[model samples]
Target: MKAILIEKPGDESCMKLGETAPPALTPGSVRIRNVACGVNRADLLQRQGFYPPPAGASPILGLECAGRIAEAAADVTSFRAGERVIALLPGGGYAEESVVDAGSVLRLPDALDFETGAGAIETLLTVFLNVFQLGGLPSGGTVLVHGGGSGIGTTTIDLVKRAGGRVVATVGSDEKARRCRELGADAVANYRSEDWVEVAKQATGGRGVDVVLDSIGGSYLDGNLRALAEDGRLVLIGLMGGAKAELPLGALLSRRLSVIGSTLRTRSPSAKAAIVTAFQARFGADFAAGRIRPVIHRVFPLAEAPEAHRMLKASTHFGKVVLRVRDDER
Candidate 1:
């Protein structure tokens, strides 16, 4: 098997591709001949000596992958060998093959190609779980998504709009704002040039939004609070800006607002499986129904995983960047 191994955390140049033994499948786990994998920002942070793979996880960098089941453990009953599936990984997605708990392996919708499936689990799970499950996004609610051109951002825009919510998005430039509008955002604000909270307020007719899905932490944390309506929920998924921030405690109390943080990669297997199951039961039909679809901006071959990481860091892409492990996987 070929894998991208990070001998030590450093710059993007540190990711090295070399031959490695394939991991053997364990009880309740399945071996996947990886067809595709998604490049996540956390992968870059990990390589730069910031984020580390959780305990007991593979040292490799990928967070989600789509592939065929080469072997299914005896303890697994619902899935079998040769099934096309997408699975969430605690780590080790940046390889030719990987293993995952069967409970985390989801059958790919026939309508989806492997590249799309490969990029699905991580961003979609993060958005669905935080925005809807934890953030309490309601049907007919007004929703604001920061970093709207990001993979998770675009996914949130699609899900919220399809669920009957009005979408407002904040982006860095005019180009991303255009993409956000095309993706069903009722309004788009250029966060780099304008005050997004004001734009959000105007878009919502001065009532503010019912929910805010924010990834950039730090100073934006206070702004997120300002953008929310009374009883609004603010879900923080990343602190791309910085970890520490001056929060508006008075506003939080006065408006009865809620702020919750989420990270899918570090969650326990049972927690990941619970979200997989919950999404399967509720939004699975959306995939087949054509309401929610994977949005991939670019696809790079597996060996060029470093380039994929660079692309993600550039923040030029409007949606997900997926690595094509094998063109025939679909």
Candidate 2:
């Protein structure tokens, strides 16, 4: 099989299309002939040797893909060969095929194309797991989301609105702020030129929000706490802005705040399966009905994975950047 191979852990120039052995199918897993795959910031980190795949997992960079089941383990009864599906992978999605745990695969809705499926599954599961499950965002409650124009940010805004909650999104530019509002954010703040903590509090009448969905990590920790209402939860999912910070134990105790750190990549298969099940139960219908979808900023071919990485690194995109592995007729 041909894949985007990394000659070394470095810049985009290190990647190139090359041949490699196809992955062997494992029990309780399915082999997918990938049509498309989603590009994520984690991929870039992995390429630069900052992140490594978990033990016994594929060393490939992609985390999610959309495709058809080329084969399925006999124990997997819910899905069969030739079924359209999207899967959350531990790795190995940047290829012609990927073998994934059966429990992590979702049937791709007919309403969506392969590219959309590729783009939506990862971000949807990430946001659902962090903002709703871990953060415990109540219906009609308000949440402050940092990096509002990101794939996770846009997905969070859509999901929160559908769940009857409010969103205050913080973006780096005015255009991103406008897009966030159009995507259902109740309020949008240009973090580059505005005080996001103030905007978050003012959006909820100075009471602050019930949750703070943050990806910026350390640099935003103090501000995230200030943006949250009493008893609010701060769900940290990424470390885009460095990872070390001093915790103000006094404020945390006084405000009764909870801080949670989460990541989907290193989770056990069973744990990931549970998250997938919960996401399907809650939002599967919404996706099948075309009521919600991922916002795609661009799509590149499989061989151009290097270019995709460059674009994501530049942070100029508003949503997901996808790689088309093969043409989809339907």
Per-candidate Cα lDDT values, in order, are 0.86, 0.91
What lDDT score is found at residue 260 in candidate 2? Answer: 96
Residue ranges of candidate 2 with Cα displaced over 4 Å: 328-330
Candidate 1, run of 10 with poorest lDDT: 286-295
Q: Would you give me the overall lDDT of model 1? A: 0.86
Give candidate 2's error at residue 87 in angstroms: 0.5
How well is each residue in 25-125 modelled by candidate 1, as lDDT tens digits? 88889999999998888888888988888888888889999988898888888888888888899888989899988878888787788898888888888
Residue-by-residue lDDT tens digits, candidate 2, 84-139: 99999989999999998998999888888899889988899999998889999988
Candidate 2 whole-model C-alpha lDDT, 0 to 1? 0.91
* TM-scores vs. true structure, each candidate: 0.97, 0.98
Among these predicted structures, which one has the highest TM-score?
2
Using lDDT as the measure, which candidate wins? 2
Pairs of residues at least 3 apart in sequence or in different chains that clash in candidate 1: none
Model 2: pairs clashing at backbone N, Cα or C within 3 Å:
none
